[model samples]
Target: MKRRQTNTNFFDLTNLSGDIRGGAISFLVAVPLCLGIALASGAPLFAGIIAGLVGGLVVGLFSRSALSISGPEAGLIVVTLSAIETLGSFPAFLLATCIAGLMQIGLGFARAGMVSNFFPSSVIKGMLAGIGIILIIKQLPHLVGYDADAAEGLALFQPGGFNIIEQLRMSLGQFSGVAMLIALSSLAVFYLWGRLLFQQRAFVKNVPAALIVVLLGIFINELVRMVFPQLALRGNHLVQLPVPGSPQEFLQLFTMPDFSQWNNPLVYTSAVAIALVASLEALLSVEATDELDPLKRKTPANHELKAQGIGNIVSGLIGGIPLTSVIVRSSVSINAGARTRLAALVHGTLLLICVVTLPTLLNKIPWASLAAILLVTGYKLARIEVFKGVFAEGPAKFIPFAVTIIAILLTDLLTGIGIGMITGIVFILREHYQNTHRVRTEHANNITRIHVSLGDHVSFLSKAKLLKLLKNIPDNAVVEIDGTGSSYIDSDVIKAIENFGVAACQRNIQLVFLPARPAESPVYTLTELADNYRRNNSERGFRHDSQPHLHRQVNPTPI
Candidate 1:
């Protein structure tokens, strides 16, 4: 029998070693991801690296989740790009990043993390699927070696006039044969290695297929370039590292925001937009990471908010893009067998080393390989299995999921998520209304007895149902409303019930409230009646203290 250790603390040496191994794998994964996200975000390539490092080191140190990896995210590309444009410069955007971080910290302190619970599962899942599709479509051009001078960090598809199919068609005509071959080959090798060989080999099981694909792609690209000098792919298509002449030159790359922009209202407006979008993305990523954790550990959402705030602050200070709990890196960490937060810490250290010492080797890496990796990531995220599962859940779930997917494909991420969320909320409200005002009439001893059962939650949206149920009640009928089981009885439902009570009184109908308490005045509106009942119940230890054994009693009210 294994003895249980008293200490559940995070610093065990065994755990640390696992974290180190996981971190190394995460580092390898993050390098390409950081560069890709940065390139996608329209920021300098180095800025993405800085965000990844800070996310790993700072956020990793402060975060409560042992397995979460943080960095620049593709989801935040729109916000970052807009911030840069609105703020007029990268430095001005840095200021907004700092302010957004501060706002997140404040939200944490306010304990607003529980707000995520309000988001429906269907909507969140739909958003993830949408992002996955976006990732695949956006990276397609780079995979085919047609480097269009388009905005880097925008969504894969554009709304209104611009569309993904049109962009894809344009990109296909300008494809590079060499780059395409390298990308397709890298993808094939990755799939074969992960599928056929990984299951049989212990040593290679933990090795990232992405790293192997990258190495193979680089080698193939180099060989092709040597043999065909006339069809040379320019260095611009490859990853470029800023070659610093000296320590001073390297220091020059670190730029601070000009606070003079603070006076501009547009800057503040952009900051607000950045803060909202970044917060939403961070919350969503945190939720996704929690779900992906193998240990089933729940991350303290508020703590995560504070950690992200700290990461953004540090990232901004050093001229890095704003950071978040990125799904790609977090997923990589889990897939790599990270056991603790130390893995995240180690990943940051590896990033620092790569940027500082391996700039030349890093620059040699091809865009096609990274695109292949992202393509695989996209496939994993928007798997057909998810669609099948949604369909199995019934039309209610499928509608929101399909709507979100289409909305994202047609418009943008935020718009798509918004539509899905709205649809989900509407569904919930409809269900609530249906459940709350169910009226069943029983005919006994020449009198009609009506039983009304309110739902678990009764809000203003349920008023229509309540009114309709009350209007159909037989004249002089005995009515009994059961609110004892209700957890939430809203004011609207209360008002409607009160009006029904008055009508019942005029018709000589007797109205009885179930789980009745002594000294409770029956002459009150629905809202007042519920409030009065609640007060009486609290004093008498009714309804909430224990389940009362329900028994039907004879009543003398006439119908």
Candidate 2:
């Protein structure tokens, strides 16, 4: 029989090739995204590129994930812009980036990676849906061939008292037929390229749909300029690359942080903001990316944190914007048939080469095509399937998801997530209380017997109801606690049961524990019981021989 391969060596070569192809495509996609996100953050254009390069080359190499893509993300636009404004300079923000990176490293060591797991699935889905709406709104102007200055104050629906509808209505006269054609054609090609022909056609699969769309957009723009100069859109709507004359010029573009101002309050505050936002974004991306992974491979979260920390450290050192695992690029990589980390590494290498050697070529790409790509991405993220699924999960989940989406649109990402998370927690607590606090009062042998079944997991939140039940127990009654049904019994619950057991003994009343076992004995003090009852149950097998019975001794005193 052929031995099954335990190691992942078979895909090693395949992964390399896949990485090169995916990386090339990712690099193409990243160019515009880097610049767009940087511009959005009110930072220098180079900052986004630096973050992409470091995220790919450094984070990719160090990350446990095989397919996650890292770069400057739109999610951090608010925080980055705010930090830049508060710090008063880009260099000061760099100091914060370094400090944030250090904090991330510390968080990893502290095993804080489990933070994302605590977030309800409904809230996370809502957060993504909210981001999708933001992307669609933000890219609307770009699709229509109008480039607005990158700033945070600009609302999605309103731009200086004019809503999106009004702006679109007013800008209709200024629309470039050529740009419109390019945008429409690029979208068309992107769609056709993903069809059966591209999958089965050998030569077609090799072509990057995004690149083709971009080139067509550029060609159309140039053709329009030559044939109808009056209808031509200005170069401001196109992607622009910095022309570095020499190696020295390229080196000089990198800005270093001033260590002398590290102690400034603004610097520390900016660092905290960066650390919090970057961590949240990265964790969220990891969750989404894992869901997208075809093999269902789980990326170690703590490892991811460390990798991001290293990437941010390197990115900041080279004057880059803070880096995180961006869902957009990671999704693109997955959709592009990327099989391993090689794809991410290749993408970074291609980006570096493109920036260094083909600056003019990159600058020729039209912004409309990039906007179209993002529009498609936004649509995918906020698709009807997501809404249908969340709705099917029930109102408890759907309400928070819907609330989070609306909150993000009205407020910001952080605030929106916070609101959704709070709503989700409340629902969870309510569910817990409802499930745990039920009392079944039945008559047994001329005495009242109350049977209370605890929930699977008990926390301090359920303590009050348990205490009330204990205090209200009628005298000369029998109480039976079926702890076997409970997966977890909290310390507070154990304390209440023990105190009640003593009270029952004093009243000459019977307190019986069903399926009684030494592990579930209330005779021991609450401090002696393990926090996790399931572990104790497993260690002490549930055999009939292990069951303990209360023996009545002659003239025994109630203790």
| Strongest candidate by TM-score | 1
Q: Write model 2 residue lDDT over 1-559, tens digit each, in one string.
A: 1211211222367455555666776777788778877988889988888998998899988887767889888778878999999988999899899999999998889998999788788887887787777667766666777655323222354324225566566456557666677778978987888799677987666666766777788888888889988877667677777879999999988999877877799998988889988988888888877777776766778888998999888888889999999877887677667777878888888888889999988887777877777677677778899999999989899999999898877766667888999999989887777567455676757888666655556667788878777788887776656565555567677777656665565675566555422334344422234333323432332112224334222231111
Q: Candidate 2: which pairs clash?
A: 19-342, 19-343, 23-347
- Over the stretch 1-559, how does candidate 1's per-residue lDDT look in tens digits? 1111211234457566556666875676577667766776768877888999999989888888767788887668777887787767888888888877888898899988887777777887787787778767877887878655223332545643335677678778877887888889988876777675565886566555666777887888788879986554556567666667778877876778767777877767776776677777778777776666666666778888888888888898788998888776666666556667787888998888878878778778777776777677777778899899988998778888888888877777677778888898878766665566555667878899777766666667778867877787777677778766566666666666666665665676766666423224333333446456456533332122123335375442312
C-alpha lDDT values of all predictions: 0.72, 0.74
Give all TM-scores, in the order shown: 0.83, 0.82
- lDDT at position 162, candidate 2: 21
Worst 10 residues of 1 by lDDT: 1-10
Q: List the residue pairs that clash in candidate 1.
A: 40-152, 40-153, 494-526, 494-527, 498-526
What's the count of clashing pairs in each model shown? 5, 3
